[model samples]
Target: PDFSHRLAEYAAALSTRLVDLRRTLAEQRPDTYLPDLATSLNNQSVRLAALGQTEQALQAITEAVDLYRTLAEQRPDTYLPDLATSLNNQ
Candidate 1:
């Protein structure tokens, strides 16, 4: 339980860092960073859900799903599965 709690905290921090990274990188390098942001968001959602932060979990997953949709549109073979996974998490 302690390990789970620690991991959840780490995930939340990682999510925040990814958002900050996106702000810095998205305009210039979306293809490089957006998927990382999406994955981070998805993980954040799962962690938030596990911690019983329902509204935050939904928000994170919704953002992830949106990013995944755009990524999937560009590279279906690579990102479609990720989109499906994020949707399943949602």
Candidate 2:
């Protein structure tokens, strides 16, 4: 088995799941899931970017950044660093 390719496939699937989780958040149900999803998406985006899927990686990172930014606005001290990190990554 080609381990690298398999890893990319796994990262792609994780990105898709992150998108789904973001959509769920958009349905007006803001809860614990949003932050976790954003974190997961951010990590997956890094993997995808490393794997050469720049477009998808940016999309995922953008969404994660947005999510984190919103949370940061309500709690700057806690989430600002995370949002800054995401922005730096992009």
Candidate 3:
């Protein structure tokens, strides 16, 4: 149970970091970091889900889905499945 609690805590921290990363992405003048932040956010979402923090996972992944869907519309081959997976997790 300690491990589960620790995992939840870790997930919470990761979720917070993802939120910070999103903010950083928006605030950055250069767009080069956006994709990396998006990818990191996606990974954090998956980790939260794996930790059973479903609500946090859903929120993070929903953001990811939005990002991926936008990208997918521009280039389906690249981001469509990423979008689908995020949506499927819902």
Q: Residue by residue across 1-90, what tens digits does model 2's lDDT show?
A: 499888878877876786677768755667656777777778878888877889988988998899899999988998899999888887
- By TM-score, the better pick of 1 and 2 is 1
lDDT scores for all predictions? 0.86, 0.81, 0.71
Please estimate how well model 2 matches the true structure, expressed as its whole-model Cα lDDT.
0.81
Error of 3 at 35 (Å): 2.8
lDDT of 1 by residue, 1-90 (tens): 699798888877777777767747876788788898888888888877877889989999999999999999999999999999999999
Window of ten residues with lowest summed lDDT in model 1:
18-27
Residue 89 accuracy (lDDT) in model 1: 94
Better of 2 and 3 by lDDT: 2
Instruction: Please tell me which predicted candidate would have the highest lDDT against the true structure.
Output: 1
Ranking by lDDT: 1, 2, 3
How far residue 25's Cα lies from its native spot in candidate 3, in Å, is 2.9
TM-score of 3: 0.66
Q: Candidate 3: where is the Cα deviation over 4 Å? A: 29-31, 50-52
**Which stretches of model 1 miss by more than 4 angstroms?**
1-7
Q: List the residue pairs that clash in candidate 2.
A: none
